[model samples]
Target chain A: MKTTITILLTVAIMAVGQAAVAEPVKIGMITTLSTKAGYLGEEIRDGFQLAIEQEGGTLGGIPVELLVEDDGRKPEKGIQIAERFRTRDGAKIFTGIVFSNVAMAVVPKLVREDVVYLSANAGPSKLAGDGCSPNYFSVSYQNDNLDEVVGQYVSDAGHKNVYLLAPNYPAGKDHLAGFKRYYDGEIVAEVYTKLGQADYAAEIAAIRAAEPEAVFFFLPGGMGINFLKQYAQAGLNETIPVYGPAFSFDERILGAVGAAALGVKNGSQWTHDLDNPANIQFVEAFRAKYGRTPTLYASQGYDTARLIGSGLAAVGGDLSDLEPFKAALSAADFDSVRGNFAFGANRHPIQDLYIREVVQTEDGTFTNQTLEKVFSNHVDAYAESCPQ
Target chain B: MLFFVEQSLNGLQLGITLFLMSAGLTLVFGIMRVINLAHGSFYMIGAYCGATTMAATGSFLLAIGAALIGAALAGMVVEVLVLRVLYRREHLDQVLATFGLILFCNELTRIIWGRQPLFMDVPPWLGGSIELLPGLIYPIYRLAVIGVGVAVALFLWFLFSRTRLGMQIRAGAENREMIGALGVNIRLLYTLVFGLGAMLAGLAGVMAGPIMAVESGMGEDILILTFVVIVIGGIGSIRGAVVGALLVGVVDTMGRVFLPSLFRIVFSNAYADSVAASLASMAIYLLMAAILIWRPRGLFPAHS
Candidate 1:
């Protein structure tokens, strides 16, 4: 009887020890998965999942549990998901928020709780500046970076007068401000339309009357598609060249906008046609898997996942204490798809921005082709305000 | 002067689209007494069907036909399956049930079409702009929309005033039980009326599909405007819808274009632009309130 008891105890001890060593790290992804902009989150989630799957359901040779939940594009919903992830599921790592408003709502609270929040999209100005925290890292460009590149390009091209248009919202104002920062040109008019206004006839008429040498608009998602199609239909595209950030010129939007987007110059950090080895591999694999070209959002997500994998490998997957993992993450020792990518003092990306022109491929599909390097080692305007 | 003319035309075009939407909503509410929050869902459905058909056939006219038939059929199905019982229920219950229908329809579209917004191109024949004036160039499609809207208004007027079925529908609107006792098939009439209303909404959707992103929930934005148009037009009056739509459209367009310039005369350019944008969106609501105060029942109350 005593021999039997001893054998049972040893077996139970071994089983408990094995379970502790094999426990997977939890990474909670709170993203917008519904609404007009749902595709943005879908691409990000797919890209991130692709990275994890490439690692055989692990990151940095350690098993990980990726928990993804849709926020329905609501800040309140995002906060609820974050709280549940932290308190109930014990998730220490979080990523995948597409919109800036939800990011602002969720990131500050999560970072304060000693959890790392890696942003796959939406690097709002506030988070990049005075509100910057060590626990937060943005794998994507700052919200204004893409617009700033276009502004610089437009200015360099000697366009003396430009008409600016954007939806009337916080991000809209931020984009116009970013453009003006680098654009040394005359602003004929600055117009803010109602958010979600489908019809742009009034705005188009105003643009024609003003007759600016060039037009720069910051409409994203369905708004962009509407503006581009109507702008083309109104015959404005023939006389006045148009410029914008890359948000509206992604592959999915290009398919929707078709020839309207062709030849339009937009700003982006990465394109599927990027020649780097990491980007090449990523593009091919993504297209093979999803049967669609990867957008800049997908690149950011894939980079974010790889960055986390690097941290996990450095710490040998031990997350009980976050200091070593934090140090490893700060190191940023990963091959980014965007060549020469690094973290700024505020933990936002300091990388190259390229001017990409939309083109129809030989196969008759619309996609972007990188034309010129607009900015190299570019730091965000708000990064200087960061205490770090 | 050219800018003013173009802006006015733009206003008229917007008014026409709103008219198409409000006319249908008013008819359903006037004749059937069902407050359908799901009216927008039908609009969305029509756009989806139009877009899918456009992709498959590459013919805009066929797409329009598909949209009309699809929306009318969907409306009849809803009338039979869900709305027939709601006619006897309270307004609050009707609102709740229709709201649920909107959710179901939205989800159903998402499941079928996927989350990505679908694209529909303007028909090639009507693709370009024409010079309305020496300096003013306007899209041929916008003018076509205005033409269509005017044609539809005339048709509705003739149907209500001259046709036998129209008489029954008008009489039915006056008193549901009286029409039933007078040997009309009230159930079939109600279904037909609902289907006609849905068809009008579908026409609006097809017209809008090429201009806007044909995506899920695209209906809700215009739906709010349609509601406002109906309320301002007298809930059950077609004439009210016409006048209300034009007034709202012109006021909205003119306000957006000229309000900032007016404010700039008094305030700084920056301050003027911000205030103008805020007030422009509010212009329609402000108009509704003023109208309600002046005429407690809309411009042409059909009931009284």
Candidate 2:
């Protein structure tokens, strides 16, 4: 009975997928869907899936088959998927990478394969800097670019003393360095917690003692959740205000932290409650389909799918024609939900930044409301750092 | 003072959770001599099932009750099918098998629930935060977790000391053949004990859902800290697990807080900045290394 059921399910799945791909161009979505980062990957897949499905399985007059596969969040596994997509799947273009390590492993191969990699995520500094590849383009900005924005926002807010805190990872180090680059603020304290360290009482106490005017952090995922909740519980609000990147309070974290995220000033490239027809359409469509606010990760994924589709249309889906595809991707001609995003000289998106406020809806669902534009057509520092 | 009291309470609350996880893992290892990496998988399963059941039935108590029972049943099913084979095998074999179980659980979760995180709400009765000290509110649900942990610890202590089944477990731990010779149903005992450990793990999961997001693969994320507790509290000893959990909870909290500032005082500001950052991150692991070096057998080794 089990075997029979399994076979039946497999057959059904194959037929549904094949029917979708029957006429449209086939694009392979090499992503992680069975590990720690799977939730984010799923959100990405949903954003793309909804877009493709709503377009009646056609993109730019081509029936699009997004062949989804899990990389298991392993670098080797990601490389293998890339290989399979190029050799076996005959994939012309690729998108969807959540981890920087996996992106690093796949980029060199994408260069060799001559496949235009429209990176929806994984904005590693190396790709934006000396290691920039002509075949590779990032729809997402550099990781530290957000930190640099945080630097500018806080410094311009006239806060002289700021404490920098992050998990003691390479990303944390880069983020602190990024913030320090633009802000001429006095560093009263800079602390790093272990990755996956949920408890932060001691850190909170230390912050309380040091008494910085402001605190900026770059914690993401569950670590961010842990930090925000604990910081609030420790009564640091009476002492210091917190400021940092927007990812900590993205749509994915809405109900888990509840009202704790209110008043947390964040630097965001795009948010759900932005005042634009494209963003309005994106958020409404996303909400209508998924019954939830689209996270920036999801927004990026949607933009990525649309961007890749545009690039494919530019080249008529022929990856072998490198010059057209490269030029098309470099143009960054897509109605991004983040508003007009165009590629800078380094082939990374140069977009506006907004200071968003976390507001509660009537149903208690949380969404970001853009309060003010922090930076317009902001190009990252790493772009100038890149000679290319 | 109110803030300190609240954070310490929070620390104690977190310690309660670590205790629940450590209790289950220690028992499975101490007597069964099985390295079940899938232990956290059961916890994940419980959280998923409990939250889902609650969402479906709209009964939070029923959801938690079902969570424990569901986890135990799943534990037994796994023991019967896969774990029974690895019982007498080498530790490496057990590790490999359980590691495979972790992967299976992860994939199975993705297949069953898509890739999105499920929102798990605490029943209205248990959801709100409390103020043990003025202006220092702690979540009421977290304090309840501490209560549950204490109750479970007492129940376990009494069961192991007085109950006949507990005596059999003790005997089996000392000599498996002797218990078998005494006409104990050794296979069933193993099955029941595994189930009980799984129930504890599930309880921790069910309680933690509202506090943390219920997503696939969260088991692996927290499994490391649970293991750290098990190692610090000598493996298989409940008391050791409890003490070890407390030490780890406090040290981890303190390290992340204090280490960076201490470094800033002793060294050049920039050098201290980097050094303190790294050291603060590693403080708990450093503490673990120090403890292990001093006491190779752990602070309290249970003699089975």
Candidate 3:
């Protein structure tokens, strides 16, 4: 009787040990989760989770664990989270950072440590240019892509004079430079307001005085909502059309701005209405799961997840060696939600950009509707600066 | 000349908004001797209440009423529960407590409303712009804000100077112990004063709801400016708050408008713009420093 009990105990222990050997890969997601701009991270998280859910709690047929921590929109906090994820959790692959500043702080160090970092958002120009790394990949567009598209579109539309406005920040200056790259027109005025400014009465009055044929602004989050509402209230929207990147006209922002954002032309790489199987499935699945239309940030997050999944599958879920996994990621083997998506030599996105107009659906919800393709297979201008 | 008029009007509108915010902050400091960093929390609460009420009932008047009552109730509750104990404590303790309250209120609002900012539109009656001058169009909502600010200032003056309650409150601000000795319920008076101050802040919040994003931490941005207004005007003086608010608002607006153009004559356009924008944001601080250098107690020192 003692021998029979010992055999049963040994069998049970062996079964448990076998299960432990197949433990899931840990993917650390360090993103902004608490701030006025927390919604951006929320959408990204929801989108990334939706893809995993669609795969039945696994990515690319391999069980995976997603560890998400809020950076609180601070770079120092982001570094702390990354260190914890690396040392304590033993996470080898990392993704998800919402802001360029935080990304600039965290990404370089992670890549230097030989951990693969897939960027879900925040493709700062430095990362795309001189700082590009084999261990790092941006599944999202370079920071300037959307703005460059708007610049080209505005120029094509024959607007001879345009007034530009953005916050006085590095990203703001980068956006204006991107716009100027493709825009061959007279810049009537280029004003940089204080970052996080609530009022635009003085600036709006100045724009009226300048009498620009068109206006382009790059105020993201609540700043965009305030500017759009105030611009409409001033009755400037009726005479002078406004243009911007997708940052200002995201679904959540349009809800806040109400009818003020309607008919505003903005440039984006993906919309819910994109005519592609992956995107259609993503939008439908995301809406079914989350009960809201996904933003462009969500699209980026979903794409980043799928890309990582492809790399994992290529390595047969074995992260014991990272060279093969990196190679698989660089090969770009995944169906991206943004159609024709590819990685440039610098590992930033090379994809078509489109102009989307804010429109109210039949159900009376505000969202972006794809208007026309603006740039086909567009690559970031900084690709040449990176030695890949 | 037309551009100047439009810019000046814009400055006046900004000044009026600042006045509403500073009035409450100054009153609270003057009466309670409590430096409430959470004063901004009341503004946030007012905005949230107003925006929620506006969304549900679709009545702007009801929204205004809701904001006033909501903020006043919150203020009175804080005065009774937490601040009553801290009344005799050091200003550092009060500051620490109020700062914690600001975080608490911000997080509480986020939990209730979610992180997405709430939307409040200008009431349809006040939606469009009016032709103020030839080639100068301004939003009617802004003009309404100016009108409301002016009316409230007049009402505040009447309440402080003409009413018996106003005299007692002024006396309390002058000497809290003496007023209590004269049979005035000091605790009740403090609570009432805090409520009134919170209500004024709420009015500012609701007025700003249409123009600003009604989100958590919305109050912090304006609160800094309010503090500047109080400091420049005088800590306890309503007259000082009024003058300080208008001056800060006008200087800020005009500097933002004209400084870039002025700099362009001397520097390259792009260089001038960046330099001027940085300087314009600093203009009010420079004004405050200059004023402090001349009059250390502010433009109107109420105590002496």
Interface RMSD of each: 0.9, 3.5, 0.8
By DockQ, the candidates rank as 3, 1, 2
Sorted by lDDT, highest first, which candidate order results? 1, 3, 2
DockQ of 3: 0.79
Task: Report the alpha-carbon TM-score of model 1 versus the true structure.
Answer: 0.97
What's the lDDT for candidate 2? Answer: 0.80
Tell me the TM-score of model 2: 0.87
Task: Tell me the tens digit of each residue's lDDT in model 1 across A1-388.
Answer: 9999999999999999988867799999999888778889999999999999999999999899999999998999999999999999999999999999999999998899879999999989999999999999999988999999999999999999999999999999999999999999998888899999988999898888888999999999989999999899988898999999999999988988888888999999888888899899999999899988999888988999999999999999988899899889878899999978888889888899999999999999899999999999999999999996
How would you encode candidate 3's per-residue C-alpha lDDT over A1-388 as one tens digit per residue? 9999999999999989978888999999999778788889999999999889889888888889999999999999999999999999999999999999999999998899869999888999999999999888999889989999999999999999999999999999999999999999999888999888889999998988888999999999889999999999988899999999999999988888988998999999999999999999999999898888899999999999999889889998989889999899988899999889888899988899999999988998789999999899999999999985
Error of 3 at A186 (Å): 1.2
> Model 2 segments beyond 4 Å from truth?
A1-26, A50-58, A62-64, A156-160, A233-240, B1-14, B49-64, B120-144
Candidate 1 chain B: 10-residue stretch with minimal lDDT: B129-138
Residue-wise lDDT of candidate 2 within A1-388, one digit each (tens)? 9999999999999999977755656677778776756777877888888777767886654567898888877899888888898888778778888878788888866766767787777888888888887877888778777777778889889999998888777878887888898889898877777776655655665676677999999887776766676576555654688887876778777556656666788877888877778788988998899887788888888888888768777877665567887897788777888877899888888988777777888877776778888788988777877776
Q: Model 3 Cα displacement at A214 (Å)? A: 0.5
DockQ per candidate:
0.76, 0.27, 0.79
Model 1 ranges with Cα > 4 A deviation: A1-16
Q: Residue B175's C-alpha lDDT in candidate 2?
A: 92
Which lDDT tens digits does candidate 3 get at residues B20-73? 888888898888888989888888899899999999999999999999999999
